[model samples]
Target: MERTLVLCKPDAVQRGLVGQILTRFEQKGLKLVGMKLRQFPKELLEQHYSDHKERPFFPSLVGFMGSGPVVAMALEGIDAIAVVRGLMGKTNAREAAPGTIRGDLGMSFSNNLVHGSDSAESAAKELALFFPGADELVDWTPCTLEWSYSVGEELKG
Candidate 1:
């Protein structure tokens, strides 16, 4: 199965929508392999968001991320990265579609309720950042996945 990292941002935790947000991924048949609630340290946040360091909005982004506790998760499923992004909708709540997580519950661009890995490479980086222990994840097959994959098809790492 493809694995992706998903983050229920500070706002979501403060607003008590973590359960609802996670429910969408579970309902979509994504397996939750690892999860935790964490208060991000500035160093970790800087490392995690280093790519945006040169951007004008980088400070605000880091400030918001470190402001409260966030729920980080590792989800596994077919095309998990893409699937999670689809569920999250666009970054701007106003531009997100009606049925997506952001569209339905998000208040603004900066306060968008969730974050999902944009690619396999990003998934690895983010997952490592959130779950530093190599053995933190429990790998197991989800019973229902037998019906989702075709015979002889192997899941991607």
Candidate 2:
């Protein structure tokens, strides 16, 4: 099973849309394995968006992220990295499609409201960065979630 990291950014938390955002994933058959309500320190946020460190928007991005708590998650499923991004839609909410999370809810580019790992390698790096050492993530069995999984769990009877 492949795993991807998902983050409902500070805006989503402030807007009280974490449950709504999460439901989209759960309904799409992505298995929610690890999740938490947390905030990143300045240094961690800097490291997480290091590639953007050189970008002009990096300071604002860091400030926005540190503004409030965000929901960080680890989801397990087939092709999870891409699947979650597809659900999140374009970074520019204006350019996203109607049914997508960003299109439906977000506004500014800086406040895109969500983040998902962009690739398998990124998934590994991000999951570790967001969710750190053992059991930091909360585990819960979604009742009847056997219907959603990676590998052959899709063929469940």
Candidate 3:
């Protein structure tokens, strides 16, 4: 199984969309192994967005992220990284597909409602940033797992 980190940004939390956002993942069959809501401190944001530190938008990005609380989650499933990203839609809300979360609710690129790790490597790093000691994440097998993912050549029940 793959694991990914998902962040319902401050915009989503402030707008009361945390449940809606989480519901999309749950309905898509991803397992929520860990979750929490917390304010993003500048130091944490620096590590979380280290790749973009030199970019011009880094300051604004950090400031905005630290402005409010965010819902951080660790999701596990087959292709969880890509699946979560797809559910979040394009980074630019205006360009997101109609059925996606950003397309349906986000109004701006900077204030995009959600953030999903872009790749497995990044997922591990991001998961560590938001959820230290990831080993503690739950390993419960969802009763509906059989319906959500294939097991070898067949579905498991």
Candidate 1 ranges beyond 4 A from true positions? 147-157
Q: List the residue pairs that clash in candidate 2.
A: none
* Worst lDDT 10-window in candidate 2: 148-157
Arranged by lDDT with the best first, the candidates are 1, 3, 2
Which lDDT value does model 1 have at 37? Answer: 95
Which ranges of candidate 3 are over 4 A from the true structure? 134-136, 152-157
Tens digits of per-residue lDDT for model 1, 22-135:
999998888999999999898898888899999999999999999999999999987899999999999999899998999999869999989899999999999999998979
Model 2 TM-score on a 0 to 1 scale: 0.89
Candidate number achieving the greatest TM-score relative to the actual structure: 3
Determine which window of 10 residues in candidate 3 has minimal summed lDDT: 148-157
- Give Cα-based local distance difference scores for all models: 0.91, 0.87, 0.90
lDDT of 2 by residue, 1-157 (tens): 5799988999999999999999999899888888888888999989999989989989999999999998999997768888899999999988988999999998878788999999998889888998888886555566665555442545444
Q: For candidate 3, give the lDDT of residue 34.
A: 95
Report the backbone clash tally of model 3.
0
Supply the TM-score for candidate 1: 0.93
Residue-level lDDT of model 3, residues 74-154, one tens digit each, is 999888998999999999999999989999998798999998999999998898888887475788988887677666544
Instruction: Indicate the residue-level lDDT of 23 in model 1.
Output: 94
In candidate 2, stretches whose alpha carbon ends up further than 4 angstroms from where it belongs are 137-146, 149-157
